[model samples]
Target chain A: MIENVCLGQYIPGSSILHRLDPRIKILSFVIFMIISFMSGNIFSMSILILSVAVIILLSGVPLKVYFQSTKYILFLIFLSCVFNVFYDYGEAVFKFWVLTVTLESIKNSVIIILRVTSLMFVSSSVMFTTSHSNISFAIETFMKPLSIFKINAQDIATMITISLKFVPIIFEETNKIINAQRSRGADLDNKNIIKKVKSYIPIIFPLFFLSFKRASDLAVAMESRCYNNIIKRTSIREFKISILDISCLIYIIVILIGVVYCEYLMI
Target chain B: MSALDIKNLSYIYNQGTDLEKIAVNNVNLSINDGEIIGIIGHTGSGKSTFAQMLSGTVKPTAGKIFLYGKDIWKDYKNRKEVYFKVGLVFQYPEKQLFAQTVYEDIAFGPKNQGFSEGETEEKVFEALDFVNIDKKLLNRSPFELSGGEKRRVAIAGIFAMNPGVLILDEPTSGLDPISREKIINNILSYHSKKRGAVIFISHFMEETARISDRVAIMDRGKIKMVDTPENVFYDYKSLKSINLDAPQITKIVSNIHSKGYNINKKIVTVEKGTQEILRLLRE
Candidate 1:
């Protein structure tokens, strides 16, 4: 429901981090996430968390505004922690009426929460600062290395970007349908689970129809613009790996290596 | 007493959120049985929000809506019953049709209201006939019909319920002239035959002036004027203030009146305008 509310949600800022090439930010983001997973103990998790915090600070976006994005997923994060705390079988540190909290369990819970939070915050920073069009271009460029594996990177990137684009469009269409149905006395909010599922038919029916129609229109528009599907489609300007981009990439690589070595020590 | 009465109704969107907006301010209106009212307002003037409140699609943020002198939100049971009594056809509702065949789609509302199999079929066919769609097209997939035909079928879906108050939002929008005439004529005919109250929102002033018993001018979430079509049109000053104008012929007739000639300022149609001008010129 929240996602259906508006478009052009990116917050604008003039920080140097906002000016960094989206391609480097994307690569560094992925590298950091992977390093977060590799991080085992509290110390290593702190390092990963610190990296995400630094990126968030550099983005110059209001910290509270950036964290508000995680509110929707807080339920899932809590569920994970609660499940881990109870189900993890280890040396008990505290016991209460047939329930036991163990040292290993608490540590595992903290690691997972920190890992997920770090991933969410870092990726959000990228989305907050980078425009969607630039992200699409960066994704297309980064996938070029996948050509060695005999994959069409452009096709993959285009598909990803198109799917991402449709998410918001579909959300908007669904909200309109919901409002329309409600105006007709279709009470969706005060219904049981089974009834709720049935109520979705009206909203879903129109949305499916509109999405196909939109896809067809988009295809025709793309063709009219002389879109060539094959043979290394040209860009008006090519991306050059600048000094800032290289330094950011190097720093991300060093962090990944350091985290892996720390995990080795923990084991 | 009015068949439907809204007293001091107000609504706010995203009420508790930082982005909260007052879509419909405190306003009161009423509709009696067998009255056809046209509500006209520009986009975001809260006309649509008002329509939603009337049909019980939304509970007002404040105030009470009465149907037959009883509060609509008195209880959950009464609220459910009120929906069938006040049918709402959204703009381009045709796209909401999803049944495999046209008949089932048209019968959706009546069936949802718990009509028996034979009765539902009878009502669905009656609605289709009322909307003037060809009987031959009843068995076809709704998706296969032309846009205007699909729109009619969608309307027939709501008509099958045979509600006491029918509300339509921009029913003739995006249709050819002939199709527009057909839909508007169908609505007028339905109103005459059923004798039910009808509230419709439209931007086409000429068409609305022709069919509506009364016109309600809304500006910035407030109903500026509610009068018979002639009276509403005659008030050109207020209409101009709201960036709306009377029908083209009405404006010409009013201009003639301004030139110290004897003419009815209430004249709306082009034919009446011509006759009145000729009569004045003869003198």
Candidate 2:
């Protein structure tokens, strides 16, 4: 039941993006995020947008999916735009009863909207292109230095992996609970906001209880399987940054330098 | 007249998308009053989906369903009335019990249907009595009960509504043999007393054969065959081909028959097989 949620759904492909080691893909995504946020001028921001388009093409994931992912956050985008338009102090270009809109404010609002959109797409692409297992392995490798600080990095990584795994499980449990309630004449949908919030009691309480029960069962199952907290946990496939990775890293670094210098000139 | 009649029923989940799945396909089926029918299929064979459609929990994407010659989905507004008339007991339904007392949980359905306070109280006890859940445990929280008891309470919750057609999806799953037998026997007793039509969806072939008056074998969102248990079990070859199998005793008895030990092909119960085998040995 929980499997129905298609957020960050991966599209399998035989393209070069699909063949890249997941760790390299993850590190590159982080660099992409830095470039996206640091883009100051429209020129560099347009380059960032172009890079997203290129990556989407290379990943072989459809553009429709990118729009679908953005659909979930459309409310926030709209809210930000509305808030920036009337509230920001600037020379007025248009006037209503109490609303004053300006070109500068509009430009600022568009920049924020673009930045947010870029952030959403960048993170989602990482999720859509790479498998969760590889991301977990990457996280473990990335946190290797934390062991020196007397923290159990392996445990943290395993926890993150299991939590990611249970996101679907929780959703499934929620669906079951909702269906059970619906069968009892509980109308969750097509109800007013007040009624909807009240309807959530039936869904939420059962889900919360089941989640705890599942966690207990999982803990017992884990103990039965002899799970350990060993830091040097090995995997079947090891991640190694190759020449291809270095070249890609250098290319992104050059783009970042050029974009930042261009933004400086714009200012 | 048949208690429930489903004609050309079809249902699809997430239609018009890549994830579209045909859960139930054009299925025509009927259930007479006081009859106990078993629906057996592998997981995702559309047994549960069919049961859900019959229980009015799922609206068929196509076709018509008549309960007592009246269209069940006549109007969208009175859909809740349909739900009340045809009760559904989902798999692991016990997890839905959240009331402070088992009595309250059982009465919740009846109360929702607009039954009076006194009538609701009596119906709650009646449901408790029907399921054989002791009256002493009625005031206690359902969380304190064992898994089997909780399942019974959940079933009782639906039973309080006294639906004319009862649909249970995999009711015996994930339980001890003794609990499973008790639950099945309780359902049988309920059917006998109430004279209501029952559709028990299960994967346990042996129990289904023992209890069912008619068996519907489903495979890949379609009913492969529907007939009396003896008739359906006779075509063991085709049954297996569609990911279904006959009861083990039927196979053994058929093997015995092939050995010139004259035994009836219609034998369903182990006791009957034993009697036939002894009769053959004596002859």
Candidate 3:
């Protein structure tokens, strides 16, 4: 059940999105998110969704994976839509005791669902195309100017990369621990809330201990190899911008302008 | 009825995804009560997945698993009961220990089985005796114990439940020779006292050969053969074909037999090999 989550997980491929500059991908993801929020009418929203779909196809990652990443957030989106349907004040399409379904509310709910879903797909598409190390490196490059404010970009990047690497490892460890506990007759499926929480104690303690041991061992391994923060790090894979990246950026800017214009016309 | 019966059992991981893999495939086997079955296979030959399926930890993607002629997954509510009946001791089980003390850890299983306080304690002590753990160490934290001791405590945790069939997956790997022997002995003693079926999975051919009543060879997610040690070891060619080797003694005996020696080629244990070679020399 835990393995189904594909959010922030990179799928290795050689597609155009995979080969694009990580900086440009991150920048485009942010811009896409802004455009999705600004997209209000059906025309702009459909345009945003269509472009995201195209980018997802270009990413060479399966559409199922992106859907899986967004599946967990579907409940949140549904809740917000339900709230908008009941709470919004406008023309009543249907009336009931203490409740009314308004045409405006229906429009708001549709826009909310489309906006949130498009945002989720865009983010998951970006993550599926970019590896964790590349993402961290891009962040480091973006934060390099912060060094003037007494910040260490490389250290922050190393931390992010290590944490991202640990996510999968820790997930595997948790699964092992859960299986082990289950084998020992731990009733993890108890319906009683208190009992269920208590069952996790066995799993949590071992996971915490294992994570600490791993972190300390990793630190020792790095130190043994003469790792020092005082020295600047050099990466083997250097980021270089290409014409494809520039074209992709320009395409995103055009989309941003179109979305803003549509929102202005709607207002 | 057999203690455990698996028919056309198969498990596919990540089904419908590109990462899909057939971990266990259309496997069939039956283990009798009071039997010791050794399963040997390569690293990715689906041995662990097969073991998990038998112990009811993993649900089979296809086919059925029967515990004493009853389908285990027939009713979801009874799954926990099945788990208690078929205990699994995973590789490096010591990592599973999380109780405040060794006693508490061993008692966890029996307590889960809903035994009373007195019965839980008795079962815990019995498990300790079976695994040869000292009573004095029961009060000590499981984390404070040495590697071998921690392993024994973890095994004892399973034994306290007194499962009808104990399935151990590579239980002795990464341990010293002495520790390995001790664990094997503990398992043997537990089987003798409980008279329960045992499914032992291991890379060490000699240990499996020494303990198993019938050996099952697995390859590519299928059971290639299930036969006695004598027959399985005698046919070394088939075992090697699946990237598995017979016990060292069996190999040496076969080598000696190939050199025109009149000794039996099916010797699987050191003691039996020595006796056969001594008999050949005297003749």
True contacts kept of each: 0.35, 0.30, 0.65
lDDT per prediction? 0.81, 0.81, 0.89
**Which 10 consecutive residues of model 1 chain A have the lowest summed lDDT?**
A1-10
TM-score per model over all chains: 0.85, 0.91, 0.95
DockQ of each: 0.35, 0.35, 0.57
Model 2 lDDT per residue over B123-223, tens place: 99888777888999989999999999999999999888898889899998999998898898888878878878889898888888989999998888888
Better of 2 and 3 by TM-score: 3
lDDT of 1 at B270: 76
lDDT of 2 by residue, A1-267 (tens): 112435665556577676777778778878887887888677898887777776777776666677776676966797978788886477889899888899888888888888788777767777777777777888887888997899886788778877877876677677777777777766677558997897677678767778888889989999898887853667988767777667667766777877788787656
With a 3 Å backbone cut-off (N, CA, C), the pairs that clash in candidate 2 are A2-A172
Expressed as tens digits, the lDDT of each residue in B4-51 for candidate 3 is 989999989888776788889999999999999999998999999999
Q: DockQ of candidate 2? A: 0.35
Interface RMSD of each: 3.7, 3.2, 2.5
Which portions of model 1 show Cα errors greater than 4 Å?
A: A1-20, A47-73, A93-101, A147-155, A179-199, A230-267, B13-21, B73-79, B235-241, B281-283
Error of 1 at A217 (Å): 1.6
Which residue pairs collide in model 1, if any? none
* Residue A70, candidate 2: alpha-carbon lDDT: 67
Q: Pick the candidate with the highest DockQ.
A: 3
